[model samples]
Target chain A: MEVVNRYVATRHHVEGAPTEADFEVREETLRWAPDSGEVLVRNLYVSIDPYQLNRMKRSSASHLAVDGVLPGQRITSYAAGEVVASACAEYAAGDVVAGVLGWEEYTLFKPSPGVLMSKVDAGGGFPLSHHMSVLGTSGMTAYAGLFEVCKPVKKGEKVFVSAASGSVGNLVGQFAKLAGCYVVGCAGTTAKVDLLTDKLGFDAAFNYKEEPDLKSALARHFPDGIDICFENVGGEMLEAALANMSVHGRVALSGAIAEYTGEGRRAVPDLLEMIYKRITVRGFFAWDFLPRFAEFGVVVGGWVRDGKVKVVEDVSHGLDSVPAAFAALFRGQNVGKKLVKLA
Target chain B: MEVVNRYVATRHHVEGAPTEADFEVREETLRWAPDSGEVLVRNLYVSIDPYQLNRMKRSSASHLAVDGVLPGQRITSYAAGEVVASACAEYAAGDVVAGVLGWEEYTLFKPSPGVLMSKVDAGGGFPLSHHMSVLGTSGMTAYAGLFEVCKPVKKGEKVFVSAASGSVGNLVGQFAKLAGCYVVGCAGTTAKVDLLTDKLGFDAAFNYKEEPDLKSALARHFPDGIDICFENVGGEMLEAALANMSVHGRVALSGAIAEYTGEGRRAVPDLLEMIYKRITVRGFFAWDFLPRFAEFGVVVGGWVRDGKVKVVEDVSHGLDSVPAAFAALFRGQNVGKKLVKLA
Candidate 1:
């Protein structure tokens, strides 16, 4: 059988802040048999994240994002899709699943054990987009980072979430609130900051762009000291947070969007501060914590039902908007989990 | 009642690498009796270390060495002393003790609850100087950094200890070796490197100063990547170690001697390396792990008896040499534990 698929591909290697002009839509004719445990999937939704920018760059020691998109290659993303054809016992044609699939209309792949792919259970009242956003990789990231990595006991302790209204940061703030912490967040836009406190139950929120001195901004919010920091934008932001961290503070590093386009020479002036404060600055990936995804769903799923947790989606219209939607993330145009819808 | 005691005092605020000129021997006349819960102790041995340098400098956020020595005040250090007089029943005259006291012949102090001061049994058949070296603050620091912080399972995993011949660094290397790890160490001098491999049972040793490219030197030693880093010298050594760190690597941050003498703007070029590898860079103080001192003494004390562990003292004579002894630590003049002897 012959099938035509349209996908977004990088025009060339990306530099600095990515723009819509850097990507072009390409067509591919996929022809394949369902080998042993193989299946053909129709793409439904795809998630855009900062780490993808690492893969689009030239090779270096800091090229951590393993699944890099090559020139003229379909961009790889965390996608939700429907299995159209399968030779696997695990999935049927109509079963909805989430995995690291292509940014295309169709994906031809095999599901081995322990692959990034997972079937999404639709028993929850929320929409499939919610599953792709809050209950998916992003949600799991916030949960694992807060519970497993930061391990904040709360007790009215300060919790600082950078990129406050973004995909993982929003969930982290809500969770911290539930855990009895004095939650605070810093985002790029005033609208995003307002959403953090006004809608997401954050105790305090500030626009980072409004305050050039982040260290002082953090200190004003966290007079006592930050017990935990869910860091998204690294470099100077991280340095400022480190200065305001209390003794034995834990920093769960999820992303470093600031240094992705640069040479990644992170100047942590007070890096030695960790020695005196007994700070734990640990970096983690959500995929590494996928083993507890089911556990996270049961816990966070209840929070969502009780109206304790909030979800936001900055979604694009069609496959054509994928490039612009992804580029919008770098420019801080998207307020939450940036996703593109496809058929 | 007019007995005069000579003590080392900071002449003025110290800047950069400490020198003998920064301190002066000042004489104090004793007059007051031991008040309620107070005692007069004759210090026998004063432990000189790098952390004291922080106290000699001006204050800032990074001045985390809380017990900073004021310009005119006698320097504070972990001391082995004899209780000459006591109003508190907990300590008797002639009682041999180890505690935070002045770098002087006598210290009039009260033992508060949870005080750093404690009585030394000296029942292990080792010299009292050992109580100031391997059995004192330095020993406790090494033990805590290696065990509680690093948590190495060994199984032939690689352990890298920087400043391998210094106070805590020697003990860390020896402990990692005992724990069945392939231990490697780097130091400034070839003699220190020789002492690490030949005397301390390190699997390999390199003079970091001799090797301009530390990353390459570390790569050669840790071909499989470092499992645990008993970090002492930070900056370039830390950067090199981070580059050579394996996935799930643990860095037990003990000190950053390089930053102590210079501006602490530690530029970790590729700090994002932690995210991809899931590395844990934690800073810890030995005081946090003081409760485990007896446990360390039992385990390491046994190692001492069995001749598995060794001690090296770079002792300075008289109270006047204390400044020089402390300055020697910055100069890398001392081979092992730097100490000042006063009788």
Candidate 2:
């Protein structure tokens, strides 16, 4: 049988601003074989995250310890795929699995140590794409950052979220609403502001682009000051949030999409505000909470199914559009979880 | 008996830059009689701290339930004094007591419930002024921030300290050194830099003011990145520190002298850096460690006596120099613990 394996690859190193020229398409020859503890997967969906931009950079100093894709190596990420071939007793040929799969037509799934890929029930109510977004790392990130670090959200506490329309922020706002907190969020445009207040149930929302003065906008939105700040955009937004944070406030350092492109570095914030307010700013990695994934999946999946937690995904069709789709996250182009469907 | 009290008071609010006009010399009438559970004390020494300047501001939102100092009230602080008249049986007429005493020649010591004051040792090797600086709040601040929050410092771990020659930073460096960590520090000037490397035994020291690029300087000093950061100066220093911090590094947010004054605020740092680095930035108040003081006192006091922990006090003679002395901390003009002598 002739196997036509199509794969997306990076073209060149991305400097200051990433362009379409940064990525390229490549076709690779495929061999269909299964060794012990291996199951071949037919890639269906791939997650495109802002953090992937860091991996595209040539410098290893800034990038996380993931093996970066070279000019011709197939790009890979957390993807949901169907097991087309299998040698491992754990999987059957037609089983649906979720794991690190390549951004290609088909992938050879080797059973690496410490890898977690499980079969999903075909009868589940949620869509398969939900595994790559809300029921995936994005939701886990919001859950870990909010509940684990900034614990015990008391009723009537003011919560401020930056990048409020993004995948994580949208769910964080919904979770805060469930916690009975007065949620206020900031986004880049009026549409995002509307999404936060109207759809996500945020009590107040502001377009950071429209407001020249971020500190004043925060103060106006939260007169009593923010009790918890789900920080995603770093730069000026973090500064304004710190200035307006109340005593004993918690700032969950989830992401900083603004400075990911290595632009003119934003001004450093006043650290004295943290001390004066007794603020707790903690950084968390979702992978660290993998042990709790089953628990998280049960809880978050139920929330999504019950409509208590809303899941928003900005899906781009075709695997060839993955680079632009990932880059869009930094530009605030994606409203929710940005993903690429490789059907 | 003719009783007279000489006190220091704030004459007016400090403007853009504090001047001698901000304070005035005044002599107030004193009563010789002591009410029930009250003691009359002869003021010996008083602490001059950066937080006092915050109290001098027209508006302040301190977490410690402190109100701003009104126009005419006497400046109060943790001071050491000799009891002259006593109505409490626990204290005698000649007992040397230390508590919150005003910047005056004589102070009325009312027995505040739940307040504990140390009985000064007449034959102690350390100077009495050490109570306000090293042996008091400043020392406690360092001990708490370093040992309590940044715990389990494994041998050969890298530790970085900002404002390394200052009161708390000096002690923090020594404690880290004792724990067998490679300690690096940054100070404002060459002299302070020299003090960090030579006097404090820091593995490396740099003048942050002389280094135009803080991130590059940090990379050069801590090539592998810092494991713990004792943050005293905030703003750009904090940003650079965060960038150079190693995975799972703990940033002990003790003080941020960089933003103490009304100077233009620095840019906010990219919060994503914390997530990528998996850092923990915790703000700590010294009073939170009150329960551990007795245990800490025994350990730190022994260290002081054994010459393992060196204490530095920047003493400004006379209470009249208190405001000017405190202003020096914000300007990075003082090398160590800034204090005022009343006797």
TM agreement with the true structure for every prediction: 0.97, 0.88
Q: Which pairs of residues collide in model 1?
A: none
Candidate 1 ranges beyond 4 A from true positions: A34-36, A60-65, A263-265, B32-35, B61-65, B263-265
lDDT of 1 by residue, B87-178 (tens): 89899989998888878988877779756888888678888888888878888888898889889875798999999999999998898888
Q: What would the per-residue lDDT of candidate 1 be over residues A311-338, giving only the tens digit for each residue?
A: 8888887899988887777777888898
Predictions' DockQ, in order: 0.64, 0.47
Cα lDDT of model 2 by residue, B1-343, tens digit = 2358877777765534455677776887767554567778888888777767767777655523465676677877778889888888878899887767877778876676655576777676668887777778888898898888887458989999999988889888988898888999888899998888888788989988889899999999888988999998777788788888888888998876665665645535555567777788887788778898777767888888898887888888886787678657767888888777877
lDDT for A222 in candidate 2 is 83
- Least well predicted 10-residue stretch by lDDT in candidate 2 chain A: A264-273
- Clashing residue pairs in all predictions, respectively, total 0, 3
State the displacement of the C-alpha of residue B194, model 2, in Å, after optimal TM-score superposition.
5.6
